[model samples]
Target: MDAPQEARDADVSAIAALDEPTRRRLYDHVVRQSDPVSRDEAATALGLARQTAAFHLDRLADESLLDVVYERRSGRAGPGAGRPAKLYRRSAKQVAVSLPDRRYELAGRLLAQAVEESAATGEPVRTVLHRKAEELGTQLGEQDDNTGVLDLLERYGFEPRREGDAITLANCPFHALARAHTETVCGMNLHLLRGMLHGLGEETLTARLAPTPDRCCVRLDPGA
Candidate 1:
């Protein structure tokens, strides 16, 4: 189970940018500051040559690990401010690569939405959860133009594997949550996948609860 290929590749590239010792040092120094760090300031702090610091800092900026902003440290307006010293700060972007790929944020979003709606409408929490999950799945399927069933499954980290005519998910993206709240989460997953199948107009496969010790609670079976 992994993230989307483009995201995974970009993350790998960004992480690889930190492999160089000098570049890593420059990045660490820049991010630790409350404000952006100037090239000269970083060089002086790290005991590196000014040119060497600039080179590595630029590299980090290219990887999007750092953001570059031009500012005049001299506190001058339109006068001889000296071309606005290039400054480096940690980028607002966050990158995390998890083995077996988890998306707790996605689960949290669904659960939060369920709670809010339930509180607002006085509906049962479980009913709202299942409804929200199904809605999300429908949206995902509607937005998908080219992707098929298996492709969509893999993209979301279900780790789908075909066993004979049916496909069983090898990993659940919400594995931990499902473990803690079996009935609720599993029912939500079943409705979500059923919505997916319906939205995708998949007539040959059926989504059903088929829990096992090693795989996801929901499975895609061929026909009934």
Candidate 2:
């Protein structure tokens, strides 16, 4: 079944609010499992007591990061007397450490403006964008690694999607910035991503703007 976008967005927001350690623990619990896990299993895996696990598990559920499913289990009564335990499954949602959605919306608007300005100049949009991206990538590299780049994108409310060797900026990081200074802000993002790639030694990266209805952004080509 297809997942609802709103629900998935909520999960991403919820996870983004957590501290590093908490987020790590939560992600580890979900990603390593092949099936929905029981409260007992989670506690065991994390070396926490059942009640402790239950508490965090409930929080995750409340955040829509987890869903409760059921499986058959033996009852205390004699043979064939069994019921299903309330098992927990990681929600069909991607978790991210980022800002809220409203901010990202603003960033997109800003990018649209930048795209407009570049278009007006009769410059190939991609060329101008790539040049700006290279500048930003150089600066970002001075401060952090690839992982840091991912974190920065998340904090700015970008939903980062990673596949094999490629990373896509799924959401706009400069939503508020976009609304205030559209062109300039979008230009900055192009630079930022480029700087981030360069910092990560991904200088040979190739990025393509995603098609419409998705918003404006670039991606890293693993092969490059």
Candidate 3:
């Protein structure tokens, strides 16, 4: 699935924040340490002023690229410890973006689900894959009760375009894998979309394999 615009923008901002040399250095130093780094420790390690280190660290924390916590450096606590030092560590959040909106993460999830289900039920991998894909597609359709297939597909970066009565998918969310494993990927895509149509209560349209140059392997057309 396409990453939401807001999430994509935030990821871009986080990556852009690291373009500053000092910020990048500070980030690298913090992540490499076994423990979270205090601003003073980062400053001394990177030859940056303590104030500068604090500023960059706070920026990183704000962007959610780094996690922040407070701890007393002195072995003592309560009355004796001078103060809790602010520290920075790498955050668990992941950021990724592709220009054409590749969704290998989505593909991987489907494949993993297929494998697990097949192992458990002794079903063929292909059968499990198709079933899993359809389930996922139904889930996608359920996300917006008010939207139709075209709007839903567009929101997910399918790049749908009107072609007479049919809608041509201009971008495949699984472009690379589809190219490498055409039959399997295309079949999975076809079933997934059919499931989506079913879940959306769409009776007038149908999804079918209609591979063309510079576009997805599936098309949605009006049913008789």
Model number with the top TM-score: 3
lDDT of 1 at 67: 96
Model 3 residue runs over 4 Å out of place are: 1-3
Tens digits of per-residue lDDT, candidate 3, 94-189, equal 988787877788888898999999999999998999998998888888777787888878766688999898899999999999999999888888
lDDT of 1 by residue, 16-111 (tens): 899898999998888889999998999999999999999999989988999999988888888665788889999987887776867677788988
lDDT of 1 at 135: 90
Reference-based TM-score, model 3: 0.93
Tell me how many clashing residue pairs each candidate has.
0, 14, 0
* CA lDDT, every model vs. true structure: 0.87, 0.62, 0.88
Over 1-224, each residue of candidate 2 has an lDDT whose tens digit, in order, gives 11234554565668554444654585568657998788888878888888877877777777766888877765355557677787877777556434344344434443465478688897766555546556645664665443565665554456777767767777665565555665655656666666666666655555554433455455666555
Decreasing lDDT order of the candidates: 3, 1, 2
In terms of lDDT, model 2 sits at 0.62
TM-score of each: 0.92, 0.38, 0.93
- Models sorted by TM-score, best on top: 3, 1, 2
Query: Candidate 2 versus the native: TM-score?
Result: 0.38
